[model samples]
Target: MSDSGPTIVLLGAGHAHLGVIDDWLKHGSPPVRTILVEPRDAMQYSGMVPGWMAGEYRDEETRIALAPLVREARIDWRRCRAVGLDPVSREVLLETGERIAFDVCSIAIGGAGRAENLVGRDPRLIDIRPIDGFIERWSEAEDTAPPRRIAVIGGGAGGVELAFGARNSTSQPDVLLIAGEHGLIPGHPAAARRVVERELESQKITVLTGEAQLDDDGALTVGDKAIEPFDAILAAVGSGAPSWPRESGLPVDEDGFIRVGPTQQVEGLPHILAAGDVARRTDVRVRHSGVHAVYAGPVLATNLRRLIAGRSDLATYSPFGKDFYLFNTCRGTSILSYGAFGLKARWLRRLKDWLDRRWIARFSGR
Candidate 1:
């Protein structure tokens, strides 16, 4: 509402947006009125969440205090959810029925787990994303005496990490990982998969590689075989875009993620941009990982400022050739994978812990 400058609206407090805020704080504020709309004042750094679950970190260690950061950056922080977007009118509709106009808008709202198809829909089922809720539930489960059998759906990093965390956190070691044919991080190399499999075996965690379905009796069935009954089910499957992007008339990918160019601009909409898990860049082969989101932050920030200033010179985001993905096994060890090679060792775990701590420290001003 400032007459002196155009308004820049940032949606979601994702990792990429954290970098944007850091950049704004490091340098001076841009010549634009900035507003950050997020559902929570604190964001859990996803990278440290697995460690937190594994009892290696406290809740405060994994949390990023966005309130002080926003205050320091002199940005208006709205603690609300963005239900819809109006590209034509250049406005964002909040859940409270308020529309905030922006000259430029950036979205970094991360993805959510695809859990609609699961049967039962019981209270015991949970998703790994929207991590705060999952942590709360997990804490409650821990306090009420750990479940006898815990089942984690999906084989990706989230699932594997969650499985390991659950195994380490609970007294009961009966953890089942249902990968559904992908067989634990299919995107990684064969060696990485083997390492994970070996670690799972060493941890005494049961893994079902085939397709799994929840039966009417609350039993998990894998290829016509009814495995042990699971007291708690956690879904860490593929990420799905929230319905708001498509419902708001923005161009999106087949998976419903907002489509963006190399500069992270929303397709066909120059005034709007998107990054992190909610965005799919058309110009590059970028995976929906926290690494890519962190890398894209500065680029997104620069491009947004350029667009706001009516400058044609904008930055482009190029993903790294080999992204280093480290998985903490919760046994004082970690597996580091890049492309087709992986290394599993205790030193890697220490390195990962150090890197994660450093990243969090940057945002926490510690």
Candidate 2:
């Protein structure tokens, strides 16, 4: 953290950036000045969120305060959002109009959900992106108008987990999952789909297959059909990249996420790198997930350190095995899936809890 050497700006206190900081804590930070800029004071680990929603864990059990971690790590933490960027000049524009320059940078801000038309339709409408807000809004909703019939949008892992969590609520509300155009899990095998379908039937969660949209009156509109109304809506559909990356002229995929190489380096910009939901690996088609980000953290950290130390050799992030994929059912059981294989088990619930807690423990003293 020298004031005179090169500067590396680690934007967004995402899972991967936290990994970089932990590396500094263990092996000592690089001599280069390190700056960590993120607006949020705490990050609610997405892995444990479903469990918390199901009343299986407390609020504190799932979140880590960023202030302490940044303070202990001695990082130059900025409590402001980044509104813009200029990769050509190596500068990050802050929401406060302050521009930060860096010799190297890594962008790990989480994805941005499509929330244009759906938000203001109703007070009960909730989109699950920008997770911190979701937690806060959920708290308000819980204390006020706790929903009796909950509709979970999206068929991905997040939506599926939300459906189960809602079902396990204290009130035991009716849960309906609108899986969008792709029914249930699209990439999973037919056998895995059957396993999930069986669970949904056993749990009494109704499943709808079609793309869902918000109508003028905040109703769930699917093409020409108006779906049955629910007391609350939770949109867990996947998110695309935020606007700043593309506005800053950085190379992005069709979805607007930065494209990185095998070594986690930004596609054309070697001095800059990205990981987690904000980046897509160019060499391999890796689905964005917290599991991948947590595993790739070490590789991202190593590369950032190497560049500062004048080392030519950098580490590559290899995707781990499918055994790590665990989806909570909130039925005292969880589903494990990788490639074409999927299964649900009660012990898998304990395994999911252990894995989630272990990851959070590494970054917690608070």
Candidate 3:
């Protein structure tokens, strides 16, 4: 075996990359030169964000710093963002006007919050993706007089948690949830939806069932009705990919997310891989969440190592059979959902808090 293999670029400090680093830390040093490209030294764990919004967690608790992991694994840390990818040349272009060539690459840059109609029309609206940005904006917003009328768009898990968490906060701004055409928690099981629906009613938050569109004046219309003006608006409609990857000529699904197979390899580019929200599985339908991302991490690490070693055999990513979830609620309670099974209780909130802290602590090295 060669003492050193090819250079592998680890793009974005997302969950999957953490697994790769953790694997290297415990098992062995990186088999090849590794460089991590990210704009921030640390990233917020999406799971605990709802709790943070509800005043259950401090700012520091939600962050997982990259320094300790990188130092332990001996991976080069690039404190900048990747602006472009040239797969044809196997190089990543950084925002700092530098281009680094790589023999293999893995992207975990995460996805942008889908705010196509809501946030684009209203610049003041906050988006839930790029988690750190949302946290910063919301924290600043909370410092001033709380917005009396608040509107949260979307009905997915993130949207539901944000709506309920906002209502639970000390400010307790009146929250209006635009559940969209499919209604509350559309893809979740019947029982889970019912539990969340009951929680919303108990919180006294307004629910609008229909598609949310913006008029010319930045006003919102739900189906056929006009809603009251909101001093604060948040969009958690779901995630969308950045335009650069597609522009770079990488294969992507209709939504612009990089198309990756079971091995986390970009279609037609086996040497380049992607995972997490920024990547969409083409072989199977998989739900996008922090849970799935974490599950795919070890697979990503294994496959990346194989590619770097010039080996054809690689590992594949498979989703867990039953992934459980918890949603933050009022009065230090939470909604626990696992397929058809679901519950709402104060003790469940403690469990969710412990799980979030545990996940963060796993990599925090603090």
Model 2, span 125-234: residue lDDT tens:
78888788888887777778778898888888788888888888777789989888878977767666777888888999999888777777767776668876788888
Q: Please tell me which model should have the higher lDDT, number 2 or number 3.
A: 3
lDDT of 1 by residue, 1-366 (tens): 324469999999998999899899899779789999998968888887777877889999999888889989999988999999999888899999998998999999898766645434667788877778788888898889688789888888888998998888747558999998868897788899899999999999988888767777866778788886678888887678899999999999898999999889999998899998899989877888899999889998898889888998899888867377999999899998888897799999999999999888888862
For model 2, the local distance difference test gives 0.83
TM-score of each: 0.96, 0.94, 0.95
Question: Which is the leading candidate under lDDT?
Answer: 1
Better of 1 and 3 by lDDT: 1
Cα distance off (Å), candidate 1, residue 327 = 0.4
Model 2 / residue 298 / CA error / Å: 0.5
lDDT string, candidate 3, 115-200, tens digits: 86443567558888879989988988888767777899989898999997788776888999999888988767788888898889
True lDDT of residue 6, candidate 3: 71
Q: Estimate every model's Cα lDDT from 0 to 1.
A: 0.86, 0.83, 0.85
Model 1 lDDT, residue 327, Cα: 94
The better candidate by TM-score, 2 or 3, is 3
On TM-score, the stronger of 1 and 2 is 1
Weakest 10 consecutive residues of candidate 2 by summed lDDT: 114-123
Mark the 10 consecutive residues where model 1 has the least summed lDDT.
113-122
